[model samples]
Target: MAGTATHHGIPLRSGSGLSYRFDPGALGFELLPTGGPDWMARYEVLHTPEDLRRWVGQSRLDPTPEPEIGAEDVPAARALRDALWRIGLARVAGEGPADADLATLNAAAARPPLVPVIGQDGAAGWAAPATGAQVLSTVARDAIAVLTGPYADRIRICSGDNCALMYVDTSRPGRRRWCAMENCGNRHKVRAHRARQSGE
Candidate 1:
């Protein structure tokens, strides 16, 4: 999100038990002055720190600070997660499948920025000394790998309310519910109880 670059098209929204579809504008992504595709826009929407805090719940990973989470971080928590899900599914569904998506994410995240790799014979073959994104699309290749990597079990969508966010549940049983524990899950539970009372 910090980069000058922007991605085109809507990031596909997916879920395990159910799916919800809404335009990007519904989540507050706004159109820019320049002409572009329907989903292209500047965004007013993002996850608040509270949103994320509720999302992770009592997971093994410790909570991040309670600051104003940025517009940039939004994709990581929501769209990026869904994107990873798609990428993982596609890669796994391919021939000779192996789950290396988690590895891809770990390896990529483990890296620093790209430095140059010099070749012999005075020809420069651009290789980043590390696993980070390059000027070319090797970054995308790695990204695909990360999403479909061996840790596929950890990736899960929330069972809370009608939320459309997904997350990596690093729990012991690998079972997680709700996009946020205190709110989304609770709301769903309450709704269920009320429905039983009224017989929906």
Candidate 2:
């Protein structure tokens, strides 16, 4: 169901005040925009336990796991997300993921993931009061699946200039480009129009 859905809607706002939904196409790649290591620290959004909780709610995790996020979970999430960023980029470049990053993912995946159960209403649900570790574990496991799955070769960096968002191109023709057509794709169209007008 949720996991098998073609896209997960992540609400985002652009510098120009445009709001749009970004579908990174997988649970793990969704973590990358929260922040990363080194220069990416500027984009840091996982500031508090609540912040992490909020993100989990916003994430594609079906029947979202209400993990008891702690202060320590914050840094751990950032670390995992940064590692994922490196791994994703490496895949895009046709290079192997680094050992260190692989180790990080493996360690997280070793932990028990969020427990799922069917509710009385037959709706999907997660075991109550999950741990932060479980949340990370779930994300790591998802990453592992995508990395080793058929679409692994379809991972791509957005073609928009100055945009570094990564997404798995799951289109049947595999010709999908841009993070979102309404966002980067439309921007490219506008730029081309302006250039044409200038040349006239």
Candidate 3:
């Protein structure tokens, strides 16, 4: 199925529109789709430390004790995002993941992810005290899980026009085309309608 519906409008051009959605498939693939055909104008969602913080917070992987993201974490976060993108693309192509990308991911995975904490009331919760690296590690580990698991075969790139995002096809029919119906599906539909009218 497509992602949750939102009112975010579509931009015909690349690197202008920014839509964020969480798919039930994988977390690592979510880092992509910020930019499109234009590499230069590609809008990076996590452009600042605060953006990283918001992304992680919204992820809900480690909610409490929000890790203080600093300038140093931004580059690492970007690098990790790129690495995951490359790995995801390779998975979709039925090709081996790049050795360098694997190495980078492995290194990130080596770091400890969020650990569960038991409250005094016996209620359990998870937290990553070292937010920066731990959060990034968590994302890397998620990618690793997806890439190595059976779902890796379901990896698909969105077929939306000018949309270059990867997603895991978890539908029953396994024929999901766009990442989200509200995001690109509607745009495709409108464009097709315009074409039909123009042709007639």
Q: Superposing all C-alpha atoms, what RMSD in Å does each candidate have to the true structure?
A: 14.4, 2.0, 5.2
Task: State the lDDT at 189 in candidate 2.
Answer: 97
List, residue by residue over 71-171, the lDDT tens digit for candidate 3. 88877877777777777777777888888878888888888776667667755455545468877787788788878787878898889876676788878
In candidate 2, position 161 carries an lDDT of: 87
Pairs of residues clashing in candidate 3: none
Error of 1 at 77 (Å): 12
Model 1 misplaced regions, further than 4 Å = 1-150
Stronger candidate by TM-score (2 vs 3): 2
Candidate 1: minimum summed lDDT over ten consecutive residues — where? 25-34
Q: Relative to the true structure, how large is the alpha-carbon lDDT of every model? A: 0.36, 0.84, 0.68
lDDT of 1 by residue, 3-41 (tens): 111222222223343332212211111111111122423
Residue pairs of candidate 1 with colliding backbone atoms: 99-149, 99-150, 100-149, 101-145, 101-146, 101-148, 101-149, 102-149, 105-146, 159-178
Predicted structure with the largest lDDT when compared to the true one: 2
TM-score of 2: 0.92
Q: After superposition, how far is residue 71 of candidate 2 from its true place, in Å?
A: 1.4
For all candidates, the clash counts are 10, 0, 0
- The model with the greatest TM-score is 2
